[model samples]
Target: MGDLSTTDRTRHRRLREQGRTGRQELFDVLGAGFVCHLGVIVDGAPMVVPTVYGFDSEHVYIHGSVASRSLTGEGRTVCVTVTHVDGLVLARSVFEHGVNYRSAVIYGVPRALEGEEKLEALRLLTEHTAPGQWEYARRPNRKELAATTILAISLEEASVKIRQGPPDDADDPHDVWAGVLPLSTTWQAPVTDPSAGHDVPDHVRRRAGTRIG
Candidate 1:
């Protein structure tokens, strides 16, 4: 509920104006999407993998197969990032071109979860990506859970950055074109499988054509 405490790693040394300090700002950027890029070191090699995630007020959760190379270590530190590109900043000059976006970067030593918490985290992950599917689909069994590795990272050490609006080239004397090309994401129609043999539920139907980002 308090403003995000700034840490040495989170301090914005450049373009500080774009840096966001509010905890809700971090939530907004994260809640807008279900995917995040996770960075970690595997076998002394740096790896950045795109993965689906879930989060609560306190932690962000991600999972992988038990034998996943990136998920092999315990007590390993990681960096997770989520980003949404809102628009393109088109300026009169190429050097001034930029992107309008919302992003959050989290740093922490992730700890693997176990027992009921692990099951709950998987439910969170499934529902976060597909709102109604957790109860609609079959839950994971003991063998499935045993084959999965779920990790949770605290939200305490995180930072958000957002950039919006038109290009900042108004002051420059340029007769050329300059503007923002806005972008948005939306859910498309669902493609069904014949083997499923059922009508789409309202919970799933309602989200079709809904907007995102």
Candidate 2:
């Protein structure tokens, strides 16, 4: 909301330090990761579930089964968070050790989309899962759409917080290795399903050529 701000909000949970309050910072954090942990109230209790999400300028979309209890109902809000762990920051002192990562938390009321918008939102979700694969895949039909549920969460009251590089120590210095050991996730060669002996297409092969994370 209000195009987001580079300054932290007065609200404690909404404030972000380490100079990472920009809208682009939040977007980059979200775009770099596909899975998000969605937090919301369910049946008067707190619940957090991991789900794949897509984004436009102002809204993040998540899809699930139509019978999902976590995403249903009206006028209810949810918090969705995306995080990417870049490396493990190991300091000489145990107390100074930490993690290097980027994370974004978005707070908004969930709105369910219908008809064509549902389909479009689903396309966004699919593309977010794997870029360029949405159009390359078959489109969902009416019955399929009806069976699925898509919810739109406005990108309001969001915050981006990140920690990177080596660990920080105040005064004590120990004689040990102190640096970051970067962590990375990559895709390997795709293994063909035994059931599909030869039906696998060339496009599928091409799609699996690169790593994603």
- How many residue pairs of model 2 clash at the backbone? 0
- State the lDDT of candidate 2 residue by residue for 1-213, as single tens digits: 234543244143532344455678778887888999988887889888888899988789987552278665777777888988888988878877888888887888888899888888988888888666777667777787887889888776787778886777745556666789998777555687787666555655665546443
User: Which runs of model 2 end up more than 4 angstroms from their true locations?
Assistant: 1-16, 197-213
Instruction: Give the Cα lDDT of each candidate.
Output: 0.87, 0.75
Q: Write the per-residue lDDT of candidate 1 for residues 49-111, one digit (tens) a residue.
A: 889999999999998652278656667778999999999999877777999999999998888
Q: Report the poorest 10 consecutive residues by lDDT, candidate 1.
A: 64-73
C-alpha positional error of residue 24 in candidate 1 after TM-score superposition, expressed in Å: 0.4
